[model samples]
Target: MKKLSVSILYAILSVAPIAGAQGDIAAQVVPQVLSRSPEEIRPWRAPVFADQSAALGYNESAFSIPKGMEKQVQFWIDVYTKYTTEQGVIHDAENVETVYEIVDLKGLKTEREKQKKVDEVKKIIAARLSTPEEGERLRFQLGQKDRMQDAIFYSGRYLEDMEKIFRDSKVPVELTRLAFVESSFNIMARSKVGASGIWQIMPYTARPYKMISPVVDKRNHPLEATKLAAKLLRQNYSMLESWPLAVTGYNHGPTGVLKMTKSYETRELGELIQNVRSRKSFGFASRNFYASFLAALEVEKNANKYYGSVVWSKPLPAQDLKLPVSVKYKEIVSWFDGDDSKAQVYNPHLTHKARKGHPIPAQTVISVPKDKYNVALISLARKDRTVAMEDKKGR
Candidate 1:
C-alpha cells in the first residue's frame, strides 16, 4: 500500500457555549465530586477495552476498586480529569471543553475562612498530602474560559485515524483518548520535562519508536506517533497483564509499574497507584495517569452533561506519499505549485532546512492533498536515484 502524507488537522469552530450562571454550571458535579473524599465515594467498576478485545480480562464485567480504596481512586480521577470551563470545572469524560473556577476563593475573604476553604480545595486535589503548595496557589474559582475547546475540536479530526491504527495493531481502540490526557491533541505541544506531540512521547520512548529527534520529532505527527504508541501500549499490556497498569505504564513505564504490582503482589491498579504515591519515581503524573484516563473516559461517555453539546470536525481527505529520495525544496516545488510555503504547510514534519533547500530525508513520508498523489508520484518516479540505503540509516 502506498501511504501518502496528508494534512488532516483542519477544524470547524462552533459558536461559543451557551451562557449560564457560573453557579448553575459549577453546581453540576463540582461540590459532589470534588468535596467528597475517597471514604465517601462508592466503589464502581467500568468496562475496559470493550470496543475491540476482551481476552485480556477487559471483556469481563466492570472492575471496581478493592475495599477501602474507592475514595482514593475516585479523588484522583475527578480532579486530574477535570478541566476548567467557562461555567465550571468538568471532566474530560463529558467530552466538552468546559472549565469552572471557584466562585469563592475559599481562603481569600478572611484568614480563618481562607484557610478553611484552602483546606477544602487542598483535599479535593489531595495536594494536602502530595503538594499542598498547589492549594495555596489555587483560589476558589467559579468561571473561566474553556481553553480546551479548540483542542477538543481538533481531536475529532484525528481520533478516527488513530483508532484505525489501534485496531490494526490489535490494541484497544479506546486508548485513542489517551492523547486528550497527554497533550489535548496539540500537534506541537511540548513539555518542560521534554515530552512532546499529541502523545507527549518522551525522549526514551521516541528513540525506540524510531522517530527523528530534537529538530525533527516525528512524535508531532499524530498518525505516525499514534502507531508507535499503540505498539508500545500493546507491549505494555502483554507484560503487565492488566489494563490499568498498562495504561499507566505509558506514563510511568512498564518496568516500574510492573515492579510496583510485584512489590505488593496485587493486580489491582488502584491499589498500586495509591500505595506508591509517595515513592521517588512514582510522582503525581505517573500515579494519576491511568485513573485520569478513566475520568476522561467517563466524561466522554457522558458528553451531554460535561460538554452540553459538541460539534465534530470532519476528517481530512488526504493520501500519504513517500519520498523516493532526499530532495531539496527547489525540487519539491517543481512538483508543488512553485510555492515553498504551501509545500511546507503540507508537510509540517520537514525541518526548516528541508524546506529551505536541504534534503528532505528519503525515508520521510508526507501527507499531501488527495488529488496531488499522481502528480507527486510521477514527479518522484521520473527524477532522482534511490536513496534507499540512506533511508535505512535515517530510520
Candidate 2:
C-alpha cells in the first residue's frame, strides 16, 4: 500500500539524518544492519514487526501470506493507497492523515525486499557447517557477554561428553557442533515452548528416554542427556539421510520433520528454512535453530581473537555414591558443609526441589571432581560395610 511507503518514508525521514555526510549514515546503516547475522538481527526485528502488525491488526499466522498471494495483495494495496475518497468525504488534513495512517501501504515492495534479504542470508548460512576452528571462534563471539559466556562454557563442557559419545557410537563428528546452536551449550536452556536442556529436549520426548521425573529429570544431567540426544540424532540420521535434516529433526522430532517433508515434497533443509511456517511447525526453538547454530559457529570460530582462551574441562568424572539407608537431604548437605557447593555439580541428577518427604534415590551415579574420587570411594566403602554389618545384626 502507498500508505506503507508513506509510513516507511516517515520512518526514514524521521531518522533520515539531516543533509551532507549525515544522510550517508542511513545508506551505510542499511547494509550494516543487514549484515548482522540473523540471530543478531532477530531480537531487533521481531518486536518491530510485532508492533507494526499489531497496529495494523494483521495477525501473523504461521502462514502469513499464501505462496502466490503476497504479490497480488501488494498490488491491491498499492492500487488502494493511490486514490482518495471524494463524494461526501471529510476534507480536514487530520482526516486525510488519519485515513492515510490507517490505509497507506506504499512500502510493500521495500518491506518485501528487506524480508527477502533476511530470508536469503539465513538460508545460505543454515546448511553450512563451520570448521572446528570456525566453531571455536564463533563460540567466543557468542560468549562476549555474561549470559552467552555462561552458555558457551556450559555448552562446551557438554560438547566434550557429546563428542565422546559420538566417537564411541561411531556417529559423525559433525553432529558434535549441533549443541553449539542448540542452547549455546547451556544445560539450563529452555525454549518458549518449554523444551529444556542443552539439546532442548521437550518433556514429553524426554520422558521415554527416562530423563523426566518429578524427583529427577535426566535432561538436567548433561552426560545422560547427551547420550539420549545422540541416540535420537542417530535414529533420525538413519532416515533423513542428511545432517541438516537430522538436526532439524532434533528440533521438530522425527514425525514433525517427516510430515513437513511430505507436505513440502522436499528434503532440502535450506528450502525448508525459507518456508518460515515449516520451521515453526517443529516449534519456536527450531524455527531459528540453524540461524543460532551458524551464529555460534561463526563466533566460536573466532573466539580466541574476540575473547581470549576458553577453559575446556576434562570430562566430568563419574563416580558412585551410596547413601546410608537413604539419608535426608539436609543431612547430606550437612556432611558436605565444607564443600557443599560441590554437591550439585557432582550430583546433577539429584532433585533440587526435594523436601522432607521427597528424597533422592540411593546408589545414584554421581559426577565428582577427579581429585575427590579416592576419598569418595574409600568413604562409601566404609559406609557400605557398616550398613552391611548393621543389616546382618538386624537379621
Candidate with the greatest lDDT versus the true structure: 1
TM-score of each: 0.64, 0.55
Deviation (Å) of 70 in candidate 2: 23
lDDT of 2 at 369: 49
Clashes of each: 30, 32
How accurate locally, in lDDT, is each candidate? 0.54, 0.45
> 105-192, model 2: which lDDT tens digit per residue?
2343454453344334333433353544322111000011333333444443356556667666656544555565454454444444
Q: Which window of 10 residues has the lowest lDDT sum in candidate 1?
A: 27-36
lDDT of 1 by residue, 106-195 (tens): 225443544455345435654432455433333232322243344455565577678778877877666787776676565655554666
Show where candidate 2 strays beyond 4 Å: 1-146, 155-158, 189-194, 276-284, 305-325, 331-335, 354-357
lDDT for model 1 comes to 0.54
Model 1 residue runs over 4 Å out of place are 1-51, 54-57, 60-147, 213-216, 276-278, 329-346, 374-395
